[model samples]
Target: PFTPVEHDTTQEVYTLLHSMSHALVSTASDQCGLATESISEMIMPAIPAIVLYAKSAEHFALGGMATLFETRIHPWVDHTIDYTEQCLLDPPCSRDETGAACHACLHLNTVSCESMNEYLDRRRLVGGYDSTPFWDI
Candidate 1:
């Protein structure tokens, strides 16, 4: 039940999901009182989903994420959608030969991203250059 073409497609989907996860984490940091580096991501491309979790050793748990999910989830998601609509590093970032991703946009710190900040594209989240946005789909 495997094919090379399907594998490529899966990787692309994973990148999209991963980028979206980082976007949410960054937005959560801004709105939820959690540090960007304190959040981590788990991407399940098969399920086409990502999970953002708090990973901090300095405390037993950070209540910010809990509070966000419990009360501010809707606004949190709205903010993430709005945030990804544009990047401070856009234009150059969007047309970069390295593919539309950069630290200023969809990247997370090494401690937060298990992928070493690779395989990300902001276009995957916002749509550009003919790629339909994940949110749109």
Candidate 2:
């Protein structure tokens, strides 16, 4: 069986060094434009250094809802696995699941999980999937 592992300072140093290597990668990042904000969750693109950020005090996007949930505007999430499962359980989705999968932000603008799944499919068409997901939480 796989043994549980703990992260220590020495291990952290290695992790940093490894990240510096060419083989390491970065996921979707929305630091585009100028504003600076924290990211909680995102579906990473195949390209490196792609992280999606939440809305700034200035501007926002249609995907704003998802970002908000990631940052958890008020208190933190209740830490339930059900919520996470709900995000990936979109029904009647497409077969071409090559791109970004669904990211279960607490407030993804979608009215339902099904919609969120479809959105992820759309992202796949536009941005190819990356092995490393952009998880800001």
Candidate 3:
């Protein structure tokens, strides 16, 4: 059983990783042909990594991820980094009370998210207030 303070810290880290996972999946969808809803995230908090994969056979049949990784991986990564720098609803989204996570920027559908859309913050990736961004700008 985690103490309340430890639990809070754990949740914060989870949200940061989970938000990043959503961001990656969203950007990958644009580079690849897969729909954002068709991809799922598996967050490994201990390792601090997220694995994105197709949620359904239909999405896998399209071979979008395979093709993207085989040839366009670099571009995909670049796009994700660039894409996270700004949001369609910037300023307000970045300053939102939720620590910069929102539907327009980082939220995913229930089928693709294991956390029920909770514990997410774009600031973890893009930087905010007193915290530094996880990615190099």
* Native-structure RMSD, model 3: 3.4
- Could you tell me the lDDT of residue 7 within candidate 1? 76
Model 3, C-alpha of 9: deviation from truth (Å)? 3.8
Q: What does candidate 2's lDDT look like per residue over 18-109, in tens digits?
A: 22210111111221222222332332222322233344443454255455446643332222222222334344222235322334322233
Residue 39 accuracy (lDDT) in model 3? 85
Work out the TM-score per prediction: 0.87, 0.21, 0.84
lDDT of 3 at 25: 88
Give candidate 2's TM-score: 0.21
Q: Write candidate 3's Cα lDDT for 49-105 as tens digits.
A: 788888776746358878887888888878877878888888998988867877787
lDDT of each: 0.81, 0.28, 0.79
**Which 10 consecutive positions of candidate 1 have the poorest summed lDDT?**
1-10
How does candidate 1 score on lDDT?
0.81
**TM-score: model 3 vs. ground truth:** 0.84
Candidate 2 lDDT for residue 85 = 27
Clashing pairs in 3: none
